[model samples]
Target: METNTEPQLPYMPGLAGVPAAESKVCDIDGQKGILFYRGYPIEELAEKSTFEETSYMLLYGQLPTKEQLDGFTHELVHHRRLKYKLIDLMKTLPETGHPMDALAAAVGALGMFYPHINVMDAAQRHGACVRLIAKLPTIVAAFHRMRRGDRDVLPNDKLNHAANFLYMLNEQEPDPFHAKILDTCLVLHAEHSMNASTFSARVTGSSLADSYAVVASAVGTLSGPLHGGANEDVLDMLQEIGTVENVIPWLDKAQAAKRKIPGFGHREYKVKDPRAKILQRLAEQLFARYGSTPLYDIAVKLESVMEERVGSKGIYPNVDFYSGLVYQKLGIPMDLFTPVFAIARVSGWLAHWMEQLENNRIFRPSQVYVGAPPRSYTSIDRR
Candidate 1:
């Protein structure tokens, strides 16, 4: 028998369960369905902290002092406005283009306008974080309006981050209740452990790319249907179900046909996603305030039926489940769902970028090539 001589390397498809890098930015207890950002439980932060404060914590690894938070928020508020040239550039994008593509394009172009090319400078990194977190909502809202031939609604200094975005998107001030709900949504989405987009940011940052490029790469990754568009899909799923009575039949048909029920399962969670619980409550609150809708009723029935069918298998509602209903109630357009996710996750991406820079090593993972080993090229049309 010929002796076999080949390296035996364990392969994990999609790099699953691989420890890509050490990160202090965020962690998940998948077994328990819990998430933490910089040592704070997500529940505590979502209940007690604002997006700005959560962003500060994720960036600096600690909650800010009162004075520190005030200063940070002031910087964010002041930097919210985009340069007119950037706005003019946004006007030139095809109005019907996906918002995520527009966002990625604008952000990549942003690299040309800002002086954040120096990735090693601490102050420059901080400025880049502030500018990105502040301006993303403005950029997203601007494109939303411009595409509709509506004039840009300037950011309101008096409003906090979430409310301001709502105001800019809709050209009217949002209710305080609605603003708080949106803020909690942002806090919940701001970070997750080693997610695809954060990993994209880290890998791009490993090349010492500037902040804009790093974020743009992550945005592009998130635009893919597999990663960031689940919420929108969930909304569509709800709309298709149409009524509480239709849910059981629809889910039965979907499961029998082996179609994935959007928002019903997560790779990371054996239990219901904690963020989904918060979002569900927010949805109920929204319904209570605005009165109920057919979609929410369908969502409720679907969750109950799904729990009965597969809950024992640890297949349950993830964050995307109820979040679509919440977003729809908040009046965000369906196409803007992922862009809003990008808005929240930018802080997390930057946090990962900074953490990647702290121990900068270019990511060059090896692969197991399994093609024909040594085949010589023959002359064309050789018999």
Candidate 2:
């Protein structure tokens, strides 16, 4: 690695305890269970704004006026198609593959095609952001079809980002209510300060990697359970319980061992995760719309158990806790849950990647050596 700076400083604060150096986009008041993006509360934005508007605010650091948001939305709609080169590359990957894997590969391929793949120019970086925000959903949805022996779904110029995505998945236009729910899901997922995937993106950006490469790295990290798959695990846990009567007992056993109930607690939020509250409300609305399903009832029971069994101050649901039930209530497929997470979180990832690039710093975090001193090299004959 090239360096003008040498003899790097060490920082070995305990994992899950180290304060992040600084962040420009989000503030996590973990004690209060509050999350704000660019100084705006998630609840206020979720209530009054569209996902597109919120995504804009996160990326650009100010909420757009009606016209500004419209123009931004218009440009996204216009650039929905992937470069032909990218689509062809997608055809080469195995058809029976995870959608996130396919997304990672496709994102990496951008680095191959770019003449300035590692360039950090401002205009080039901005263009990269636009392409990613526009193309990611289509890439994810196309991979969904590929896994099922279907052809790549063409992007729709008419519908907005999230609706067009759902339309591609099912080969039909989304109903207004469902589209709204999905859009809200996108807004909720868009940014969460410095979550796993966003940090990966920022780390890559800090290393001077291209945005696509940064995003590809994010796709890899997001495929993990402890980070992005909480909602899916939430469903799996509910399935294991299967009835309202089972919730309390399940919580009692899990809490007795201090086993995490996937969505029940957060590293930051000692209280209720606000995103969970919003999603829980959405879950209720969907329950009212379509009538209660077993999953919804199970989720409610689990929520009650967490707050009752564990002290409310100690354990409350996080975003991942309620999102799966919301998706279940909306009739979305279970396997699509985490990809849905990616689709929403892409906005925040892009925003942070761009932000990190603007004032680049390689994230070479130091490790504290705690090893045996003066180890001797062993020869093969010594055995």
Candidate 3:
């Protein structure tokens, strides 16, 4: 036999373009800049559906009827209150910790309060899903308050999901306009097919971990700058630019140094991200109500400059670009941005978790060996 040597296939860094699993939960058409959940267009969902309705659709795979939505809304509202022990746990967390860090820790601790259930039981999984969704906003709001030496505000069941979160965080009821804006933001952020955090969620859930642990893993993933933290960076960039005149100089320096302009590009979007478009409209509407700030003008000019320079390369403003401005106008603290992302994304995370459990498999991908050939071990004292 003749020994033949041939080059092996190149490894895809970061598993780019790899299809790890099948999902009916979300569909993304990157070329068209379209996103859907269970065959419903995201634009339609964001415009017509409330976050509660969207969450139910993502979780149960269809738009709920009036009766079903009523029950689902009731369950979500009823479970919004955190256990007293959980609040005490939040109190003990260092006030200096980032909200994302505090959120992941709090969610992980939820596994302790609500013990693991039968992974295969549909009802038990649904219950866990509801608890995680309901309690996440409370956890986020409590951490926000606790970090600032403010008293924790309890959840008000009378308010809708988005309104209740704002109430808890601000310790006062939000105006209806502000509440609707937050609700739309939540719907926009609810799901994206196989993003970094969602992948972390499904991978963790594949090991038969409880839903809390799975979501905790995702929260950790989203805490990274490359993901959920991008919104904060976008805001920081706009603040640094300060004025419309500074936008051109900043872009020139950034381009010369090859530094990324945060919020200008996304891997999955060739056109402007649909979510970004919606957020842009929301930001404008917010500016109309609250009056456009200097930073919003800077953002608009920066977006125009980026579009002129890089739009042909499939680079455009993403969901992060305008979302931070909207949140800032809504009076959300800068640090809590990612925590709010987690609050919205938990629905998608739970959906992926349940789907992973439905078709169980351990996620153990093989890596190409790129090390020394097999050799005998040497003694510790020997070289």
Best-first order by TM-score: 3, 1, 2
RMSD in Å for candidate 1, one decimal?
A: 2.1
Question: Which has the better lDDT: candidate 2, or candidate 3?
Answer: 3
In the range 1-383, model 3's lDDT, one tens digit per residue, is 33234555568888899888899999998899999999999889988999999999999899999999999999999999999999999899999999999999999999999995877898999899999999999999999898889999999989999999999998899999999999999999999989999999999999998888999999999999888888999989988888899999989999999999999888899999999999999999998978988988998899898999999999999999999999999999999999999999999999888888878898987666587765778998997
Model 1 residue 49 CA deviation in Å = 0.2
Q: Compare the candidates by lDDT and give the number of the best one.
A: 1
Clashing pairs in 2: 30-268
Please give the ranking of all candidate structures by lDDT, highest first, separated by commas.
1, 3, 2
Off by over 4 Å in 1: 1-8, 381-383
Each candidate structure's TM-score, on Cα atoms with residue i matched to residue i, is 0.97, 0.91, 0.97
Scored against the true structure, residue 289 in model 1 reaches a CA lDDT of 83
Model 1 over residues 95-209: C-alpha lDDT tens digits? 9999999999989988889954689889999999999999999999999999999988899999999999999999899999999999999999999978899899999999989
- lDDT at position 239, candidate 1: 89
Model 3 accuracy (lDDT, Cα):
0.92
For model 2, how does the per-residue alpha-carbon lDDT over 1-383 read when each residue is reduced to its tens digit?
Answer: 33334564465443456554466788888887788889898888888878778878888899999898998888778767777778778877886666777878887886676548545666676667777788778887877776777877788888888789888888889887888888888888888887777778888878887777888899899988778778888889989988888888877888789887788777788888899889988888877887877877878777776677675567788888888988877666777788788777878888888777666778877665556665568999996
Q: Which residue pairs in candidate 3 collide?
A: none
